[model samples]
Target chain A: MTVDLRRAPAEKAVAWRRSPAGPPRASQKRQTVIRQRQYWGRLFVLPAVVLVSLLIIVPSIQGLYYSFTNWNGRSATWVGLDNYINGIFLSPDFARIALNSVCVVLSVPFGVALSVIVANLLANNLWGRAWFRGIYFLPIALSWVVIGITFAYLLSGRGPINGLLSSVGLGMFSQDWLGGETSALISIILVFNWSYFGINVVLLFTGMTTADASITEAARLDGAHGVKMFFNIVIPQVRRYVELCLILTMAAAITSIFALIYTMTSGGPGVSTTTLEYALYTRSFSLGHFSQGAAFGILLFLISLVFAVVRLRAGVKADDD
Target chain B: MTDRNSTIETDTSNDVPLSATPPRVAPPRSSSAAHRTGGRRVGDRISALFSTGLTRIVLVGLAAGTIAPLVFMVFKSLTKQDGTNAVTFDAWAAVLNGKLPQAGLISLQVSVIAILVILSIATLAAFGFAKLSFTGSQPIMATIIVLMLVPGQTFIITEYFNFSHLGLIGNIPAVGVLYGVTQIPFATFILTNFFRAIPDELVEAAIIDGASYPRVFWSIFLPLARPAMVTVGVLAFIGVWNDLLIALLFLPTPGSRTLSVVMAGAQDTRTFDVSQVMAGSLLSAIPCIIVYVIFQRQIAVGLTAGTGK
Candidate 1:
């Protein structure tokens, strides 16, 4: 009891020191503590710095150099702007893949909107809530490789999905989902949303379920209820989560859909579903054009780097506040 | 706590927790409040435009929509292609001798090594960022944030080139090291927030008693940060386990094939057997699905940690 009593004053002093930050206000011992924090902090953070630099920093510089070369995974000569020029205008394949990546961005609003609506549904007062959550989030746990196969099986011409449609007299609506040019990109986007929507649903529902109770109650008492209360009141609170979901989903779409596309379509139907990430893979590893692939990778890196900068700036500023 | 861990948490550890930890303790409490919404489909049998049964039916349908593909894949893999969908292990039997299981073993080996590599690197880096205060710390962290923003695609080409140059291609441990390297920034970011949540008094008191920083860290913080470590470790596990492209490029040989690469091969023009495809997909997916089942709640917390709450 006495130990607690004696420690209380020191704790208070520490708290006091924290509330009003200034070197002028700190005692000699407190100053030492701050110095200690700084020394140890630097020691801990540097390995990650060195490691990340090796992994990404050095490689990115090498990638930039490779972009300016005529290298095909072998010896090379300088080929300034040739790759970029081809990537932007001359190469029809590159342009198609670039457009397909935009299709990923266009697919985002559907995902976010559907996730929000379903999250609201799951947040309702109901039995079997946990079961529903488990079911919805199940796909999020599966790898893209697995989701790709599952979709491929279902969308095949003689698959069970078409069988079910035919049994129900709806066979005309079920085409060879992954076999056509026009429908192939749409199918990719749809499956992409299917594979991931559960994650965002759980994410948004977690945010919505955790909104301030008193505020929600206040809104309820003020005759704002149902969809109106959800839109007008609850959404503002969970908007940060919504934004986080957007940034993450957009990033994943840009660089990480290679598995799904590679497995399901192989950028098929004459490159209908080819996104930039897939193009990068085929150009480098498949076609043995490492330099061109490096250029494509650089282009995507710059795009995602922009998002990363915005997020980091916001993160740093938020920390300051 | 164990129930929550079943949810698999590391997927969202990328967000640097600008706001810190204590705020996170309260989120689950509101999940209970979600159970108490006013007359909004209360009594489990009350509703408006449609009866509650209809709502439940719709919900069950939606749930089926999400998980049916996985269930279908599993059953199809275990069933015979004898035209009657009779449950048999023909696909499973064939796949066991095929490349799928071999690639699975490779993935298992790689994921284990990658998890260890990531944990060792991320643990100390996170501790430093969370506990050690130094000049330029903020700027250094900001740089990490920006580096993280650069997608893996940005570096994969050159990384492949460098690895090929070094002849590290098809080497499982090298890919493991790469996995660890890619994950450091995010894991460190999560661990730093978690480490910062430890009260300063304990460390200060230990320091005053003539204890070294490493001693205090190992003795005090490591034990306290166990859950966070598990969370970060499992998150890293998911990342390494789920990857396909880099592993495919780096380990192109048939013998070095990882589970995802083998699954990708299922769709190749040379082989179009649906059962083999499903079987390979299951082999690749089951580990992550099992992890998710075991760590469901922890996964949600880790995932949400960087949402700026």
Candidate 2:
């Protein structure tokens, strides 16, 4: 690819030479221009990369290194493995948060599948498809904070869900959704799905639009109707899109704050919704164990990195084939 | 799942494909079946219209449902019941009075500053990435892609200490710098792709006229990259404005708290002014929506361009 990018000038030169007007001198001039462009292109991208390095990458590395040390947020003295030891082996919160993170991850695939099914219906050009698509996607752009607040309202004992339930004579099912430990994690996961499904729906809808109709037709001709055609033909065609959505959602899920937890429960009735990001925040900023926070952050980073690597490697391999 | 046959056949029957046409499945040629269903009857047209109406109704209902919370929030901001459980403009007025507690003014200031700084850095970085390719360019690009893929929270704790040790804790600059930094990976990624989409030949033509890299960037690429720039700006603004965890950790001081932190803490209280809370929420949302509206066209175009590329 680099060689091709470099040879673009030469390729252009040949094209100019083969033109009907036969502008030989112009082609030579064009050749010089291409050579110059290559030089300039490199210069243009330098500043952004430098800033990215300084702000994101360097601090990340520092954090990773600090994760191995026992330095306070204020002082700089490294005691190797102390922070990590405290964070992982000793801290039960780590295990609970890890479990919470797992729960977060698990919700996304279910959400993705639901969104795709909804997206397929929207894509079918049935009545009001565009409006449905818009509705589904509206929440995608909302801040997690806002969603948390909204869901907090909805899930409250005095909130609308409870109000409606009592009105419908099913008040027994309505409990303190965000208050109970067991239900809090489930509530937040459900909120996440509601918030994110729109985006997945949009991506899937777009992917469905691009799906070759002939492929579906071919399936139909082969006696593959309905579910078979959808699963075998349509789903396979949109695998790349599904993967994209999955990776994006996974990344978001890992990094996302416990906004609802912060708002409604405060990581209680007992740390039920304390996600990796939330746990890191509390340990560092709230608890003032800066080193421990940094260590947890590194652990969170590593976990996210593992998932990211798998996603990227898969994408690259698919691209190659 | 509904039969894919009905949907696919109906869809394709209306619009034909241009290439690699598939074999068509003919409808059953039975007059008896048609008669049973009253095919070609006036009622069929009415039923089709009825289904269309039903779909529209459902769509409208869902759209309303989706937007209702936001709408209610705005309404809640305007109604004044009391200091607590009240939905009124008083909360908004109080916030605007500039005497409100830690979260309001500071959050607004921090968010504004963060957006400006992020936009500047991202735009510059995008310009560089899109138009220039230095040595080891492939690796740098790959690194960026990797960075973007990595969940942003991975580095927050490190960044917290990095800034704190640098005496940037509770500092507005630290907040801005952190927001700007995390956003760079994605902003640069999106913008670079945008920059790349500008025909190379156009840049070469500018150079041929003796225009320098800076000159070409200013005159040609900048104008053409407007759609992309807007998209980046909107995304950056939204991300920075809506950010909570980072701000909560870094800007821990009462005076430095962003609105999210303020709201998060406020929920712990017994008697809350729901109206004021709604107002604050609306305030947070307004800027994002404004940016979205202003750049909607460009965002759409940029999104399509990014997806296509």
Candidate 3:
């Protein structure tokens, strides 16, 4: 970490003066280098700071400002807290959409827990470990659009599931999974799990990879097997990974799009599947209520921020202890 | 398919028993059976066999759930519903001849532009954050972390008007820029760690050798940062390629749609072309898959290195 700036001539002169080396006036050189380092530091950071400010920092502030105003995608006027009051309290979409988001959030822990269990098994070198790992992690690479299209194809009224059921004389069991108010959100949840479980598996696998295997071995030597070993030995070791995964899952699921809903049900069967993002889109772009959408965005942001802050604090405390 | 198989083969061969020098896994029990004559190793073998069999069945079920949608998409994309019971390639043909190319081009444009902007800004920001001391740096980093938690939907309404004011309304480039910026926090956070991992002595030596900080960065830091840069680039590209909401919002102009946007658009025009959308989705995924396959080890290492801690 030393910064030294001695001109070539000075080095040559010092060399020429009999004694080839005696630190070469370290004090004077250190001063020059420190001053030069300050200049370099400023130069290195200027462009990055400017771009970040322009693109992310300023826009974020603008988002905060716009939450209070009734701007209709054009000119803006101050409306105090009217937008927030109307969007959050008066409008019923906020409650409905918030509930939908909660539904999505509630499903994440189950999905993450399942993924971790499966990952622990795979990490243990059980049957078909490599193939199972690949299969478990494949859906993460697929887009939500693809997930929606595929699920809709399977669950649509005249789709293959019904076709199979009718042919098998189980026609009574067939239902329009993606077409009913009761079924739309459930179908989306299933598709969401299938699409995201791969990522969870990968995260869990990564977590398990770092686990101290000697601990597990000791547990196994003590006659622990399967579920017992997982709960008592492996789980504690991956607590941070599990927590981080939960936070990420909650963040992603909460802001999930109407894409699947847009394609499969279009937030229909009585707007039952309209999550916050979907509702925000519907309000702003579809319904021309800009400030309301901004308000919804703010609420979503605040909720996500709360969870992130909680996770961050937990992470810091974990580090401290 | 052959390429994918080869990559899988490579991963398997390279990853066999990493703890090779000293046997990591315990050897199965054998000699203990002599103490219990009749109740023996035979029972353990039988139980192990039974467990492995049951595990295989469970594994198959897991695979079926994971693979079913993809298989369904492939099947639907290949077959067209012609009248009563007939199947045809009309959908696939339409996808290839028209929608595929259009969607592919749009996605490529968006992904490339998005990656370029994101890499440039993110790499610089990473350097700044990793190397330079500054006032309010910790707060700014906290803000970046907060922004990462805030979903992109939160910024959409504000950005929609902002882009409009910037005269970028209906432009795919504007949408690309937005997607790129949304990903910066992740890229910068990741790359900053990568930057910090570089030996400070290397950079100091370069500085002592009369190189400027910029020169040291370009020569020393950038070269050392290749894996991290690639990781960030790949993730950013994937994010942009898969983005539907941003495109739907800002790039509403006809023919300006990315693959995901166009795939959604296809739902309106015709009966859903499962094969076409699958083909498009698979095709959109190819560039990343290729990069991932070629650099699988680097990717695995880099991602694990960046995110694990």
* Leading candidate by TM-score: 3
Give the per-residue lDDT of model 3 (tens digit) for A1-321. Answer: 123222433454555454545455764575456556545554555565666567667766677777788887777898889888876667765666668778988998998888887777667665566667666766655667766766676887888889899999999979988777768888878777777776677777777876666656644543456665576567766766788678767777777656767766677676788887788888888889888888877888888878877887876765554
Q: Per model, how many backbone clashes are there?
A: 17, 13, 2
What local lDDT does model 2 show for residue A143?
Answer: 75
For each candidate, give its TM-score against the true structure: 0.85, 0.80, 0.86
- Could you give the CAPRI-style class of model 3? acceptable
Ordering by DockQ? 1, 2, 3
- Can you give the lDDT of residue A242 in candidate 1? 80
Instruction: Spell out the clash pairs found in candidate 3.
Output: B77-B274, B77-B275
Look at candidate 2 and tell me the lDDT of residue B145: 64
Give candidate 1 misplaced runs (Cα > 4 Å): A1-43, A309-321, B1-51, B269-271
User: CAPRI band of model 1?
Assistant: acceptable
Q: Compared with the true structure, what per-residue lDDT tens digits does model 2 show for residues A1-321?
A: 468566767777888888989579877876776566666666566666676787778877878777777667555677888888866658977778788888989889998997776666576555656556656666645677777777788788887778889899998999989888888889888877777777777777787887777766555554454455566567766666788778778777887655655775667677778887777777776787777777777777687778867876876665544
- iRMS of every model, one decimal? 9.8, 6.0, 8.9
True contacts kept of each: 0.73, 0.48, 0.43
lDDT score, residue B308, model 2?
45
Q: Candidate 1 overall Cα lDDT vs. reference?
A: 0.77
Which portions of model 2 miss their true places by more than 4 Å? Answer: A1-43, A76-79, A210-229, A316-321, B1-65, B78-120, B253-255, B293-309
User: Per-residue CA lDDT of candidate 1, range B239-292, in tens?
Assistant: 888888778888888788888887777687576777777877787778888999
Q: What tens-digit string does per-residue lDDT give for candidate 3 at B192-238?
A: 88888776778678878889877887887888888788888876765
